[model samples]
Target: MHREIGPLRALANGVFCLGLLGLAGFGAVQVAGKNWQVQDTYHLSAAFDSISGLEPGGRVFVQGVDAGVVEAIVPPSTPGDPVRLTLRIDARLRPLIRTDAEARIVTQGVVGARVVEIRPGSAEAEILPDGGVIASEKPLELADLMQKASAALERLDTVAGSAEEGLAEVNAIASAIRGGEGTLGRLLTDDEPVNRLVQLTDRGEQTLADIQDNLDALKNTWPISRYFTRRGYDDRDLALYRPNASRKSMTISESDLFDPGRAVLTKAGREQLNSVAEWTKEHLTKKTEVVIASFTDNSLDDLMAERLTQQQAEAIREYLVDNHGIDSAGWFRSRTVAAVGFGRHRPRMISAEPQGTSPDRRVEIILFTPQAAS
Candidate 1:
C-alpha cells in the first residue's frame, strides 16, 4: 500500500470524494429552506377553525421574513374544539414574537405553496412564552362558498317554480276565454249577443260616468268642501277607499311658508321642514312615501292658478330634498315626492268661493304607506 498509487486508482478516489460533497450540499440546501437556517426551534401552538391546506415542514414567516417551520397539527382533543398547530419559530427571533402575534395560513403565490405567516405585534408587547397558544385566522374555504351558492340557488328555484305556476294559470284563463267558456268569451264569440252586451255596457258606463260627474259637482259644494279639504281624496272613489293607505299629514299655510308671491320658503318654513325631517327619520319606514300638494285661489283664473301652485309645489320639494335629505325616487319607498299646485282653488276643498286669501293656498305633506307591517 505504501508503494506508488496507480493513476487509475487516484482518479477513482477523486471522483468518489466529489460525489460525497455534492450529496451533502444538496441535503443542506433543503434543510435550510425548510427550517430557515436550522437554529434551536422554539415551539409555539395556535388554534384555527380550518387551515385550508397547511402541512408540516412548510416555511413560516414573521412580518414577511423567513422565521420558522410548521411542525405538527393536533386533532381536537374534544368535539367542536379548533384544530391546534405547533409552530417551530427561530429561537433568535423569540423576542420579536409577542404574545399578541396572530398566525394565518396563506399561499406563497396565487395557487402556489402554502405557509404559516405570523403578524409581528407591537414592539412594546411582552415576548411569547415557550409553547404559548397564539391566535390564528382561518383561510377562506371553497366549502363555505359552495354552501352559500347552494342556498342562493334554492331560493332562485323556488321563485322560478312560482313564476311558472303563475304563467300556467294565466294561460289556462286565456284559453278558457278563447273557447267561449265564460261571459266574456260569449261576448267575443256571438255577434248578436255581443252587440247587445256592448250596448248594455255602453249604457252602464255612461250611467256611471254621469254619476261620477254629479259626485264631482257635489264635492265642490260649500260646507262640504271643508270636509273634503281636510280629507285629501284627490279624486279617489269613496266606494273603494282604504283608510290605511295614507298614514298622516302635516299642513303648512302658504303665508307661513312663503312671503306673498315669492316661491322661496321663508326662515320659519325652513324650521317647519326641519321638524318634518326629524319625524320622517324617526317614524317613517324606508318603504313610506311623502306627498306634497299645493293649492291656489280661483282669483287668478285657471291658468295662472295652476302655474302658481305648480311653482310653489316645486319650491317646497327643492327645500325638502336639498336641505332635508328626502328621496326623489318614485311612489314607493320614500319615493315620488309628488308636488302639485292647484292655484288658489282646489274645487274639492274650496266649493262655493275659493280661499282666495286664506290658508287654502297651502302645501300638505302626506305620508303614504303601502301596508302596515304585521
Candidate 2:
C-alpha cells in the first residue's frame, strides 16, 4: 500500500495466502471426518427364542465383524419369555461384551441380511450391563445339519445292513473254503499228507548226505587215529571215578586223574575241596564264645588303661565264676585288646577288675553285648 507494490500485485497476495492454506486444510479434513465418525455407543440386549429374522436396522455382529445397529425388537417383557433384541453396540465393544454374553440370530447367506451376533463371553465376566439381556444362540442351522445328516444316514444304514449280513456270512465261509467243505476243505483235498511231505523231504536230503560221508571218513581214521594216542593207557583207572565221569573213554585215568600226588582228586584238588565245602556250609551254626574277663590287663597298655568290656568282661567272668568263687571254670580266658587303633577307629574301653567300679564313681555298669547281627 505504500504505493505500487507491483509484481502483479505481489502475485495476487500470494494467491490469497495459498487459498487460506487450502481452506485450512479442507477444514482440517472436515473436522477429522466428523471426529472419526463419532462411534462410542452401547445398549446390547437379546433373548430371542424366535425373533423371526431380527429387524430394527439389523447388523450388530462382533466376531463376524459389523459391530453395531439392531436397536430394538421388543415383546420380551417376560410373559412366556424370548423375543428381545435391542443392540445399538459399538462402545468400542463395551469391553468386549461378557457377563455371559451370547446373542445369535445370525443368517446372512441363504438370502442374506439377518445379523445380531455379539458372542464374546468370559473375560472373567462382569462387563455386560448397559441393558444386558444376551443369552440366545441355538444356531446349528442348514436345516439342523440336514436333520443330523439324515439321522446319521439312518445309523449308517443300520450299520451297513449289519455289514452286509456280515459280508454274507463271510461269503459263505469263502464258499466253504472253495467247495471242498472245511478244515480248509481237508487241506485243499490232501494228497496223502502232501505225498508224505514230499517223501520226507527226499529222505531227509539222503540222510544228510550220508552223514557228511561218514564224517568225511571219520576224519581220516585210526584212534580215529589213536584218539590222542593209545587212549592214554586206556582210562588209566577209569579216570578216578569222574574224569568227565568216564566209563573208560580213558587217557591213563585222565592222566591219573590229573595227578600231582594222585590218590585221585586233582581237578585242582576238586576245586579246593569244593571251596572248603562251600566254606563249611557257610559256617553251619556255631556260636558259643562266652568267656570275657578283662581288667587284669595283660597290657594293651593295660587293656586301654582299663576300659575292659566284653559284656563288662562277661559280667566279670560271671562274677568271678558265680559270685567270687573263681574256680577258673575250664581255664576261663578272655582278652580283647586295642588300646588306641585309629585306622579302623578304636577307643572302646570297658574294664571288669573282677566287676569293680562302685566305690563312688557314680553308677557305671558298662556291660553291653547284644550286637551279633550279621
Candidate 3:
C-alpha cells in the first residue's frame, strides 16, 4: 500500500486532517461559551418559594439579556423557609440593578434548561447594594399545575354526579304529577285547586285594602287626629319633599358605624350614633330637615353598591328615629327626614384628598334649612 504514494491520495488525507481540526476548534468554542466566567463581577442574592429545576452554573438574564451566572444555591436552615440563590453578575451592569428589581426562575423554552430572569427596576429606584437580596417571584411548577388540574377535574365529576341525581329527582316528580299522585299532581290534573288558589289571592288583596281603609279612617278620628298630624301621618308623600338649602353636614367613616360587609350596627356604632343624636338635638330647628346618604367604593357593580348603601342608610335612620326618639316631622306637618344611598356615585372629597385615593366608604348626614327670608 505504501508503494503507490500517489498525489491524489495524499491530497485527500490532508483535507480529512484539516476538517477534524476545524471540528475540534468549533466544539471548544461552544463549551467555553456555555461556561463563560464574568470578570470583576459583583454578587447578589434572592430567595424563592420554590426553585424546582434551576441549578448552579445556570445563566442569569437582566431584562432578557445575558448578564451573569448563578453562583450557588443554599437550602433553608429551617424546613419551611425559602431557598436562597447567590448570583454573580458582571460589574458593568451594576448600575442597572436596583433595590426593587425582581428575580424569577423561568424555563428558556419548552423542556429547555431553567434560568434566572431579573426584571430591572425603574430608573428612579435606588441602586441595589452589591450583596443585597433581590425580591423573587415564586416559580410556576408543572407538578403544582397538574395537581390543581386534577382537583378541578374531581370537582367537575362531583358536580356532574349531583346534576344527574337532581335530574333523576325531577323526572320522578314529573312522572308523579302526570299520574296525579300528590297535591301538586292533583292541582295540575284538576281545575278546583286552581280556582281555590285564585279565590285565596283575591281574599288576601281585599283584606289588605280593608285594613288600609280602616287605618285611614282612624287617622281622621278626633281623638287620634292631633297625634297623627304631629307624627306626619298624612296623604302627602315624603318623596315630594325637597330641601332648598343645606345648612350643615357631618361625615363619618362607614367602618366606624357598620361592621365589614354588613348593614347591622355594632355597640361602637351605637355609641357613635349617640353622638350624632346629641348633635342633631342641639342643631335641629323647626324649619330644618335631615338627610342621610351613604357611599361605597368596594363594590364591583353599581346596583349592588346602591343596595348595600341604602340598607346602611336605613339602619342609621332607624336608630336615630326609634332609639334616640328624634322627631322626624317638621312644623309644616310633613316628614322632615330622608335617607338615600348614592353608592359610588357623587363621592365626597374628604380633607382635600384625591378621588382615586379618597375614603369612599362613608355616611354623610346633612341638615337642610329653608332658604333664608330675603
Please write out the lDDT profile of model 1 over residues 166-210, one tens digit for every residue.
556556656866787769665577797556546555655655555
Ranking by lDDT: 3, 1, 2
Model with the higher lDDT, candidate 1 or 2: 1
What's the lDDT for all of these models?
Answer: 0.70, 0.48, 0.75
lDDT of 3 by residue, 1-374 (tens): 55876999999999999999999998988876556552578899999978888999999999667888998999999989999999988788898899989999988855789999998887889999989999999896756655655655565555556555555655665686678776866668888656755655565565556555555555554434655443332432332234455467778889999997689999999999999999987877777777777888866488888888878987998889888766545421434566677777764433222345447898877776678757
Model 1: residue 367 alpha-carbon error in angstroms: 46
Cand. 1 TM to true fold: 0.36
**Candidate 1 clashes between residue pairs 3 or more apart in a chain or in different chains:** 296-343, 296-344, 296-345, 297-343, 297-344, 297-345, 305-343, 309-341, 330-335, 330-336
Candidate 2 residues 100-146, lDDT tens each?
Answer: 87777767765576776777887688888787777887753556655
Better of 1 and 2 by TM-score: 1
RMSD in Å for model 2: 43.9
Find the 10 residues in a row with the least total lDDT in model 3. Answer: 231-240
Runs of candidate 2 with Cα error greater than 4 angstroms are 1-84, 87-100, 105-123, 129-138, 169-171, 174-185, 188-374
